[model samples]
Target chain A: MEKAIRKFWPIFVLPTLGAFAIGFLWPFVWGVYLSFCRFTTVQNVSFVGLQNYANIWIDNTFTHAFFFTAAFTVVSVALINVFAFALALLLTRKLRGTNLFRTVFFMPNLIGGIVLGYIWKTLLDGVLALLDRPLLALDATAGFWGLIILMCWQQIGYMMVIYIAGLQNVPIDLIEAARVDGATDFQTLVRIKIPMVMSNITICLFLTLTNSFKLFDQNLSLTNGLPGKDSQMLALNIYDTFYARSGPQWKGIGQAKAVIFFIVVAAIALIQLRATRSKEVQQ
Target chain B: MKAKKVVSLLTASVLALSMLAGCSAQPAADSADGAAESAPAAQEESVAQESEVAQEEAPAADGAAGQVYYLNFKPEQDEDWQNVAALYTEQTGVPVTVVTAASGQYETQLMSEMAKSEAPTLFQVNGPVGLANWRDYCYDLSGTELYSHLTNESFCLKDGEEVPAIAYVIETYGIIYNKALLEKAGYTADDITSFDTLKAVADDIQARKDELGVKGAFTSAGMDASSDWRFKTHLANLPIYYEYKEDGIGSTEAIKGTYLDNYKQIYDLYITDSTCDPSELATKTANDATAEFVNGEAVFYQNGTWEYANIEALGDENLGMLPIYIGAEGEENQGLCTGSENYWCVNKNASEEDIQATLDFLTWMITSDEGRAAMSQEMGFVTPFDTFTDEFAASNPLLQDADAYIAAGKTPVDWCFSTMPSENWKNMVGSALTAYAAGTGSWDDVVTAFVDNWATEYQLSAAAAG
Candidate 1:
């Protein structure tokens, strides 16, 4: 069987390899090459060495969007993970109607991002109007807080499900032994349970971090970088630069920004995976 | 030995099967390559099928030669356009497809669609500035039959001798006022012709709000995407129009902030005398503003002829158009801002057959009686064709009012705003205005966005093209 498998490896791998080359590798290579070129349509490209990257230095909006997106990711990642974990711990207990609570909590994750943004916009506006201030009046600060709340609402449940799965796998025998040895709830939670579920924490944190960084639809439908694009995120900034700005040069600049965004996200995610992996217990 | 033989035979069959599967997949990959490289071939196949039907039914039909795919811009008139396309197909035995991009997304959609192999045969540009970006894609319509159908040749956009786009519809927009509400407030149409009178009447109505049992004098000026164009594009036009007149120039390479004070005066009036507190205008939408006019809660609404259908419940007698009195010198001579951004440009890259078909279709839509009825009745369009009658204008109360202004010798403001550097520039100005209204930003920021941003974007576009 081993000999047969080894002999037929090329035949088995050829289709998938061919598909991956066509679907991803070729386009990715082409996109990188085009990032250095200036063209409106793909057919009419002209190479202009590093000019697009140079323009990004003068683009104040790109800088603003970078910092805005960074701050948002940090806040949302913290809130989403903490709340989701707490909910997971609570729901894992032998409480009545845990299934129903879990189902209800998880339902919001099913809604589309654009729909969620618009819904929260209406709700936030109504609340803000009651205080005699419109949502857009609060400027970038209000937009920041609104997006944070929205991200928490949409993501907590999804992370909670993952956390719950992690919690269920935490050896019951060890938890019992800790309790029998006169361990308090806090000790058991801190030393026994959390250490055991570090892998889940790693996954949830990675997911929330990456998702927050790449957000677009929600940012668009909610504030749309109002007050002169003050609340614009990096992804939205890249999008606006690509499609919104009129000049042909803007598209190439937008491509450079996107390449930068990709590099930042990939590096951060990789570093996080390594850091989290080291902290994770064997169990 | 016997077991080894059986195992070897099974492995041989399995290897043969795997080899067969690999061989089968090559064409599938190759075909994808073929599809990407030859979209026109695939499209031609479909066109051939369509032409087969045309030949059986109407062999002599003019539309039989080619197919038309129009990427329409207006979302409001999308259904009407689809109906028109269907009607044309029914009449000519030709296939006509109309795809309308969502509002504010036309440029983005056009860019992507133009990159596709089966690009739109017909598309639109806003004006000269829009034509500048898309000029390379536009076919010359200089000697086409459709060019002769244009009532005014000046409305057509040209790159020197090349007539790239033709304005199909002429639209007029101004401050639409409710006559009954104005009369009830003890003001006549003549009384509110200037900025002072308009302000005075608005203040009076605001002061006596309880007595009148209404909201503020106008609707909330929303700064959302749906409504921002009202201020950024249309309202901003007033200043540009006046400045152009003062400078004695039809167009400018770069605009100086000459009439910005008048621009501020009108903007202040919109916020100060409205139902919404100026602070809340950013969250308000265009629909909320229209509701104020539709429900008779506001006597005035700053919009255009296109909004007539939305507010037709007020009846034609109560509805009237007022010039946007932005406190300009000699303001009485100003009429409604009368121009168009809806110019039809046939795609230069489309097949010659398709271009000819598009030209025929456009000429027929303007010149033929049935086509004119569809344009005016279904779409409520004010066509720029000699074939159109006053009856179409009469149906639209705002257009009728605009015609009255025109007959009285008020010079209609040419849509100089269409020459705005970019949509992003307009958006920046809109945001600055919203922020200024909200007390979040100073007006100097708006001036910078308007002046500096315009120059920067203009240079960038020029640099990009060069």
Candidate 2:
């Protein structure tokens, strides 16, 4: 069977390879090339060396957005992982209505980001209005926390399901052995269960990290970088540069920022994957 | 051996068909170019032969040789534009397509649409600043019949020697006051012409808030995207207008902070005398403000002539526009800020046939009775064309007032706001205004966002353009 499959590998692989080349690889290559050039449309391009990349360094908005995105990613990633793991642990216990709870928890993940942003905006604004606090767009701090809550609500359920799968995969015999050896709940969870679930942790971390980094739709719909663009994230910033700001050169500068954004996200993701995967148990 | 022979024959035929498909696509593109070149010569000849009588006979001469794709900017006029497009296509057998971008997304839509293989033949440039970004793609209309139709030559945007775009409609915006409510509150339109009297009436209305049926003197000055444009662009225009008048300059590379203090005075009044709490403004939308005026809860709404249809539905009789008075001297002579930001520019890069089709459609819309009715009656537009009959002018009350103001020789404040450095600059100012209203930011921040940021964005755009 293996030999037969190998003989027909060209027929099987060619279709997928063709699709990837056309859809992803070609556009990606073209996008990278465009970062170093100036043009409105892709058809008309003139190379200008590193001028675009150099300009990004001086763009105060780009730098501000970078820091904002970085801070948001860190907080969201940490909170999402912690809460998702806890929820997974609680649900995996022999408790009543666990399935129902799981379904309810995962429901927000099904909602589109734009819809979720708008829904939360109304809900949060109503509550904030009662508190007599400045509205989300006027206050940067409130906008930040609003986004963090929204991201957590939307993402934790997804990560929780992954953690639940990992929790279920723990060997019952090993757990029994730990119990027989007089292990406490905390000790067993720390020493055995967590180490065994390292692979799941790696996945949940990667998913949350990348999702937080590339967040655009929710950020756009929620605050739209109001209060003098104080709450704008990196993706929204790049979009603004490309479409919102006028002038022919802004397009090239936007492309440059996008390229740098890609590099930063890729590098950080790879480092995270490597660090987490190394800790995964062989089994 | 027989199966192998059949498979080889199949492969050969498939390869030949694929090559033929590739070869057949080029002529379609080439023919489009040929049509584009021939279109202008034919149009020029017809235009030269007949100037005023071109609308009825022109379509027969052109005979819809090419298609028209109009990337429309106005979302409110989308349905009207589509109806017109459908009507033209039905009458002339020329396929006309109108695609309206969602409000506030027109620039992005135009940018993306202009990059397509079959780009839009007709698009819009708001004014000189918007024209700068799209000048390369704009077809010169210096000798076109459309240029001859304009009542005022100054309404067209000229980039050096080329007439790149023409104002299709002239609009006015100011304090749209509810006359019945104002009379109920014991104030007349004549008495509220200047800032001091306007302030007195507004203060009286606010002081005796419970006695009056209305909520306040004005609606909530919403800080969100929809309402923010009123303050950041229109309200800001007052100070800019006065300053320009003082300096005897039309436009400047960098704006000096001349009348920003007056801008503050009007803005403060708007927030102070509004129905809603000032702190709650950041979350309020333009729709909220509109509802207040439409529901008769607020007497004054800062909007434009385009809003006539929406307000008129509420039985807004005796309602009229007042010049935005910010306590400046000689403001009593100021009419409503009357000018146009909407301009039609033909795409130079489009096929000549497509451009010709677009031009003919515009001319017919401006000239023909059916088209003029649709424009004036349906769209409520005060079109910048001499072909508009007096009947069309009398149809819209807001437009009639605008005409009266013009006739009375009140100096119409030009739409210098259209010359704003960038949309982002306006948004920044908007955000700052929101912050100020919410008491989270100071007036200094608003000034910085306006004056300092204006200079910065101007330099940035100029540098980028250069």
**Which candidate wins on TM-score?**
2
Score residue A23 of candidate 1 by CA lDDT. Answer: 67
lDDT of 2 by residue, B1-466 (tens): 6685566556555555555565455422322221222333233223222321222233442455877877777767766876776677668877776666555656765766676787789999899878877878899988877788889987999878889999988999989888888888888888887898888889898888778977888999998776888999999998988888999987776788789898999999999999888988887788899889888888888998888877886664667888889988798788889888999999999888888888888888888888898888888888788888787773666666777787988888898998788888899899889889888899999999989988898787666644
* Every prediction: chain A TM-score: 0.94, 0.98
lDDT per residue (tens digit) for residues A142-253 in model 1: 8899999999999999999999999999998999999899999999999988999999999998999899999988898888887678899999999888777665677788
Tell me how many residue pairs clash in candidate 2.
Answer: 1
Ten residues in sequence with the least summed lDDT for candidate 2 chain A: A6-15
Cα lDDT of candidate 2 equals 0.82
- lDDT tens digits by residue: candidate 1, B1-466: 6786566557666665665567555321322222222333343334333433443444345538787888778768876776777678778866677766655656766776677766789999989877766778889999987787678976888778989999988899988998998888888888877899889989999888678877988888998777989999899988888888899987776888788888888899989889888877777888999998889898889999889889989998889989899999998788888999899999999998899888888888877777788888888888777777665443787888888999999989899988788888898999999888888778898888877888887776666544
Docking class of 2: acceptable
Residue A32 displacement in candidate 2 (angstroms): 1.4
Stretches > 4 Å off in candidate 2: A1-4, A7-15, B1-63
- Residue pairs in clash, model 2: B36-B352
- The C-alpha stretches of model 1 lying farther than 4 A from their native spots are A1-26, A132-134, A180-182, B1-63, B389-394, B460-466
Error of 2 at A40 (Å): 2.2
Sequence-dependent TM-score of model 2: 0.91
